[model samples]
Target: NTAPRPWGRNSRNEVVVPFCYLDEETRKSVRDDIILAHNHWLRSLGGTASKDSGHGIKFWEAVNKKGDPEYCTLGPGKSWNDNVAINTVVIRHLANTNKLSAPIGMAHEHQRPDRDDYVRYICKELKDFDAAFERAKRADSRMTEDALCNKPGQAKLYGFRGEDYLMGVTASALALYWPVNKVNAYDYDSIMHYPTLSGDAKEECLTNEQRCHLVRWKDPGNPNDRSVAMVKENLTPSKADIDWVKATYPW
Candidate 1:
């Protein structure tokens, strides 16, 4: 993905998709298209940014009020690898809606149209009631077609625990819909998974449709499950995540 042509100082030494190899007019047009998109994004933010100084900032301030100093820095996130810090308005919107991270502001992945198909497939194929509906009940007690197929924001807010597991399933599901292609086998260890909330007292009542509190990648494994433990603890992405990001960006 790299090409050397004295393009400029790329201190990051990141993979460079060589668009400059095109004709001069083509390169200029590509740059112009980027600028046009950027300006359009800024104009969209202007509406909320201008309304009240604290509206967006205040949202973050309140959300991160009790966190550490670095956690409370209210601005665009730092860039890493070849990824740029595009904007913060989307981040603000995520916080406002109670989602941990979703730059596109999609509140939940269970609400995606595709996931409905997945659920219907599960209902038809997985006949083990203890393995299917029972587990589904723990995942989201609401378990209704509407609840599973739509964003149950208020229901989730009052019932589910706001932790890595809760957000992991939805976020990981959302990642599937990213323009990025599938780079590897589905990762049960992905942060976008719900924890095995079986014995947890607080999660005992959550519905499968509401948040069954349990999510998996491709299969449910044996008694001692590492993926289940991963959801409960640190959910840093595994090799699958790195591959997914690289493939998605493909610079």
Candidate 2:
């Protein structure tokens, strides 16, 4: 497409690439690319879009306005500044045609691997971004579950199954996220949500932001990628939750 893709570094060869893929990682990446592109596009439209929510084609005048997802208007040009502008126009057409889908909770799936969807685990920790997205994809069936492929960025499937199972997975992967976060977070909240304060209980337990702090990140420099950063907030241990973690998974 010769456009500047997200997470991409264009070379002098004029061969632009996407931060994510479009063939196998196509499904989820469609949304991802749109999200990445729109981060720049939305501002051009005279409105501020959430780095998380705005990363989709829903706002395009086509589907929202005209209807099309495979247009160059949505991608950027060689210049890094051109990506959002190009992708913004492109998504409008995609949105109109019903080709684009939602981004969040997305499953980056493709009918086939564009290059190497089965790359090695990007994080190789207990849980990986490719894995989480893959889990969402497998849970949906549109995505693939080839963990051994060695493509490095492809996703794998993950499910909590139950509180215990999630705790188990979290425990297993804790080695991945723990050493870095500093605190030996033995407590992992799965089932019991943050206690919602109604009456005088408003000041009770931790807020959502506090909870999100527990989730691991691929980027040590930018742990919080506003565009796709999962909400770890209000997802940690409460009094009961803490007790449950201690009793259930004391490790």
**Highest lDDT model number:** 1
Which residue segments of model 2 deviate by more than 4 Å?
A: 1-58, 63-214, 217-251
User: Model 1: runs farther than 4 Å from truth?
Assistant: 1-101, 104-183, 196-202, 205-212, 215-231
lDDT of 2 by residue, 21-45 (tens): 2222333335654565444333432
lDDT of each: 0.30, 0.27
Superposed by TM-score, candidate 1 places the C-alpha of residue 168 at a distance from the truth, in angstroms, of: 15
Task: Estimate TM-scores for all models.
Answer: 0.30, 0.18
Give one digit per residue, the lDDT tens place, for model 1 in 1-251.
22111222133333222111022233333444433433433333332222331112111211223542121123335322122222222211111112222332222332333332222112121112234334446776866533432333422333432222222233332223222223344344443323344333234224342233333323332332233222242234334433433333222
RMSD of model 1, in Å?
18.2
Q: 178 in model 1: Cα distance from truth in Å?
A: 7.7
- Which 10-residue window in model 1 sums to the lowest lDDT? 53-62
